[model samples]
Target: MWMGEGFVSEIQHNRGREDTMDDVGHRYLRELVQRCMVLVGKMGSLGKIKTCRMHDLMRDFCVSKAQEENFLHINNILSLKLCEVQNNKVRRLAVILESDENYIEGVKFNEYPYLSYRVCCKLELGNLNYLQTLVNVRPKTIQIPTWFKFNLLQVLKVRNKKGAQDAIQMLISRCPLIEKLHLYGHLKKLPEAHQFSPNLAKLTLSGTKLEEDPMETLKKLPNLKILCFRQAFEKISKYESVGRASFNGKNMVCSKGGFPLLQYLFLGTLYYLEEWRVEEGAMPSLCRLEIEFCSRLKMIPDGLRFIATLQELKIIDMPKPFIDSLNEGGPDFDKVKHVHSLVLKSFCQRMIIVSS
Candidate 1:
């Protein structure tokens, strides 16, 4: 049984007693259940139940309510793929809109004035409000209200162009519990502020220009596992407090302790990198490594000696020296024992091998 935060709150408020549908929010929730609205999850204490599907009737009800009052007034409404109700809702509602073109007009963050004052949001939360999961959607630079401050966030998928580093900084500061982060689209600069979240896990940063101590900030994510810098940095020194630190031996540096739990690594078009530090047998948990379009990478860091668990390896579009070195890993190479797949993008020719 999965219910949204709003429903969970109502249930908690009415616990150990008769459940009355007096509150307008509560009434709508009851009506949704009584009507047997085929919601994705369950209807009970807000955080107790989980939702897997969205009910069409629930969506229609919201639209009708908005049309009747000429505006929507609920504070928290969890939505998925409901684009048809875009124009109806007017004010004071937290909503999650994913992959819906029809609701684009009404789904803009600028439409709501109440977000800056309360923690209300349409984002998903399983049992704690500290962690939220953001699904896939178009990239857009959104202004987070001043009041939003969750402690833990598991998933953050923002694919809009307006995605700014400042907003990400604000989110990191507001929600200290961010563990898994995924950023898409062009995020040009890193926040000037020096803040960190130690509980992070998988990170995906794509199509952004790095002008600051992106790695310096990354050092703060002590629990990181998978790292993806997909075009996140072009000039690492632009955002740094000092410009010299950007290109002076620091740009290609790796952490001294290195990533202990790191499992996967992906880098794209690293133009400024002359060397990468693996910290002498670091990243003991690394298994999969993929490099693409990195012209200046001279050789693999010695830190790879620590990876006894590596299985899958991919090297694409690199200099011949780097490719030649990859084949020399000794007989006990962790990848050979565990890694059965090796994909070489540059020199592999198409061949059809028919199996019986």
Candidate 2:
């Protein structure tokens, strides 16, 4: 499942490197599918298998072999025994609690010093130095332990219901080598740091609110390639009109030489965006731009036509006034007519595709 999900290549890509999957990873996945070792699920828009599921028989066989070799340990109980910890040479551990009362309180990591992957709801991460991937864990505050170091860590994903902006920032700073990061929850604003993770290439933020223009800060990221902001901006007005009132003083302006290597940009569900100004030299390498559900966005940035690398532009569920301005002979038609592929969609009608 992990191989089919492209997580391996994704890690390489996030590290600001090309994913050379055609040589080994793709061939291995193909062989697995041909041998009926994996079940293909869904195809992506590019005609590649986007999802796959492991066969039940294969999964059982692997589990039995893993248990036999003590490579992995699955603990469903509320507590762990010191004897079990001392006995098993588990390298990967999965703890699944059957009830809310069950917690990850007594599990000891000293027994399994080589533990690399951990999946649990709660943990005390002081001893897991070799840990490479951490998921479903949220620290209470931003005060990370001075003794903890994620030197080899590549992926960190957290969901904090209370929104730990400072903690998230601290985590990013601590893991200098981290490449892919996903933060989910309510965050009023990101940290006002001058520099962020240098190698970070992909970032996804959901249910976040920014007090300042996000582009002003994000544009400084040198290696960022894919950025998605979904329901992350705060709206000040409910009216379907375009004006400064809708933005609450958060207008985006891309400066010269910004986002030098960015390729994919998605802005969705930003209900109160009023204006976006794109400077001529900004996002020089951008190839795809998508704006969706930003009803109050006034018009397409005229400076976008200056981006020679732009290939795809999509506008979905936007206000009629905004869509009308982009149609043939409309005020903004000339600004976007040069794009190789364009798609516009609204609730009132079917999607329209335009190509040049």
TM-score of each: 0.54, 0.73
- In candidate 1, stretches whose alpha carbon ends up further than 4 angstroms from where it belongs are 5-103, 107-131, 135-147, 159-164, 185-194, 232-251, 328-342, 347-356
**Model 2 lDDT tens row, 256-304:** 9989988898887776677889999999999999998877778888899
| C-alpha positional error of residue 297 in candidate 2 after TM-score superposition, expressed in Å | 0.7
TM-score of 2: 0.73
Angstrom error at residue 330, model 1? 11
Q: Stretches of candidate 2 above 4 Å error?
A: 1-52, 67-105, 109-122, 141-144, 161-163, 192-195, 232-249, 351-356
After best superposition, candidate 2 residue 61: deviation in angstroms? 3.5
The digit string of per-residue lDDT tens for model 1 on 1-356 reads 11333344543244456553224444555566667774436642213233434467778876788768755543323443335345543433445434433233334332221122122234322233433554453322344457655543545565535445555666556556666666655555654323545676777777655555466556445677878866543344667531111222225555655666777888776666767766654566777888775667776666555556767667677765655555536332332334545655543434321111
Best by TM-score: 2
Cα deviation at 86, candidate 2, in Å, is 7.5
